[model samples]
Target: MAKRFFIKTFGCQMNVNDSEKMAGLLRDMGYEKAQTPEEADIVIVNTCSVRAKPDNKAYSFIGNLKRLKKRRPDLVVAVAGCVPQKEKEQILRFPHVDLVFGTFNFVKLPQLLERVKREGRVVEILNRKIPEEEKLPLVDSYLENPFIAYVTVQRGCNRFCTYCIVPFTRGRERSVAPHLVVEEVKRLAERGVKEVHLLGQNVDFYGYQGTDLADLLYMVSEVEGVERVRFTTSHPAGFSERIARAIRDIPKVCPYVHLPPQSGSNRVLERMNRGYTREEYIEKVQMLREFVPNVALSGDFIVGFPGETEEDFEQTLSLVEECVFDQAFVFEYSPRPFTKAATFKDDVPKEVKNRRLQTLQELVKKQALERNLERVGKVEEVLIEGFSPKGSELYGRTADNKPVAVEGSEELIGKTVEVEITQASPFFLKGKPVTTGVRSKR
Candidate 1:
């Protein structure tokens, strides 16, 4: 039997894309995919440390593999990505962990695995980024969906928002060359990818050799055979008006933005070191709406930051109402190891946090339902992704990124179809296929 490998991933789309790169490298080494860790000759636990819960989950998983390591003895167990990047050699204290690599060290996997087997163990973390020529070649295969793909445009973050660990774990802002990013997109497009999401911790901070994200967007949208383009996790601080213009002008770009304002109170925002006031953040949103009227806006809200008062919580509620987000992700604050916020007193009472979270969530749901309802009578251009979980219907997202369930067949999986909205819910939209030539407003 061919040697097999298993990569268990956690957290964001970036980490999932990182796992794919590792899988492709293993495939080049003649390793096949293993369904379970127990059936694999190598097991990689690709971790995330963006939050306390996922951080702890990675440790728990590595611990459980202790018995498996004892039984297989030959199975090379490695922990890669953020948690390892943050924890470093400390993770190797887990005896069962044969190798530990950081986010930047993935390109060295084939050699690292061999060294781990010949030597006893290995721990490698690169403080500097590897060149694209070294990394992108290994990233060619193992795309989860051939029709839709994620290309990481940049890595790490420059914004040291007190509550975030990205700067420490992933290191500072490092952008792939714009030409390199475009080349990767062209390669994916050649292999039949229709849509691409440019991934980064803060895509707005993508600066390389005098080029910015807006420039990169124009480049990627020009790629031959590319149908849809999207980028995510933008910071409100430097979300330039030029970016707003690019979104407005670029027809191939998708009409959605995920900008996380973190909190709505200027006081809370300052304490979080977000750099932008509530007013400034809203101004950016206004600019986006001015450019793309039907553009969908989604955001992140931290309800119970340290020292967040009832008034501050209420301010967040007000922002949610004013922004009328297409979607919102509400998180109760949990301090991580390296964040400066962890040094402050986590003074918000647990019950108060829970109550505030529930309140904020209810408001978000109401806003989502209201926005989705507005689309009930509209026709949307949707990229048919695949069948629903039960395979009873087709599922896809509209140009504005609203989920739509249309009664269709497997044949429509990769086709872009027009759907007239029939019903709306807080989470998704229900619609049926329409044969009209109506263009999507978004």
Candidate 2:
């Protein structure tokens, strides 16, 4: 029987893409996918260390694998992703963990696994810089949805925000050549991918050999079969006017941007080493609105950082009211090892953090509902993704990336259609197809 493998992925889009790549590599090696870890001959856990919850979850899950390893001694258990990258020695201390690899050592998986079988335990963490010539070919795993694809335009991050661990885990920033990025998108388009989201720690900062993000956006938009393009996790400091103009001008580019402003107080912002003041972030938002009038803006916020006062929390609330963001990912601060902020006393009380998070979330929900309410009675072009979680309704996303549930057949899964918004909720919209058998433009 062919070896069966199971992978459980945790955290961001980048991790999801990494899991897909690993699955593809295993399939090429004549291994079949197992639906559950219990049934698999090899089980891999891809972890995240971005927050306390995900870190705790990874440890708990790996601990449970101890029994599975005992029941099936031949099982190859491995740990990969950011957590392993940061805690290499610590992770190997787990008795069941047979193989360990880091974020940059994904290409060395096969060799490491073979070495682990012979040596009983193996860890391969390479510190070598990712060269332009060694870029991995875009993995196409049809088994894991192919209609929507993520193309990594850049790797790593240069800006070391005090609270972030991306720099230590993923290393310094490196951009894939613009020509190669365009080629990847073209190949995805040929494979029936209607939408592509360019992935990077700071997407707007993408540039190499004088080709800026704006130039790359224009190139990708001109691809023949790609209907919509989006990018994520942009830093406010790196957002440029040229990139804003590109969003306004490119028909294929969606008018939504996820700019993260960790805090709204200048004092807190400076403490976090965000490189931009609260006033500058507001100015950037204004500039984006001026360029794209109908643009939907989303952002991230961290509450209860060390030394944050009631006044600082108030300023964050005030900024949210002023921005009236369509969506916001709010979090309570948690210190990570090796970050500058980790050295500071975690002065904020637990009760205070919980209260502040609740307040911010309530305001965000109200603003999101208000924004979605405006779409009522309007026709939106939606890319039909798939069925909703319960499979009782079909769902898709608008150009601004709002989820819209509509009445449609399974055949419309990969096609773009117009939906007339009838009702609005805080998280998504309800709609019906405007016309049948008429596909929207690319």
Backbone N/Cα/C clashes per model: 0, 0
Instruction: List pairs with backbone clashes in candidate 1.
Output: none
- Cα lDDT listed for each candidate: 0.87, 0.86
Write candidate 2's Cα lDDT for 36-147 as tens digits.
Answer: 9898998999999988888889889999999999999999999998998898877977988999888887876777878987998888877666544224444445335677
What 10-residue stretch in candidate 1 is worst by lDDT? 132-141
For candidate 1, write residues 250-349 as lDDT tens digits. Answer: 9999889999988999999999999999999889999899998888899998878999999998898888888888888888899988899999999998
Evaluate model 2: give its TM-score.
0.96
Clashes of 2: 0
**Candidate whose TM-score is highest:** 2
Q: What TM-score does candidate 1 get on C-alpha atoms?
A: 0.95
Alpha carbon lDDT at 140, candidate 2: 49
Which regions of candidate 1 fall more than 4 Å away from where they truly are? 133-135, 138-141, 435-442
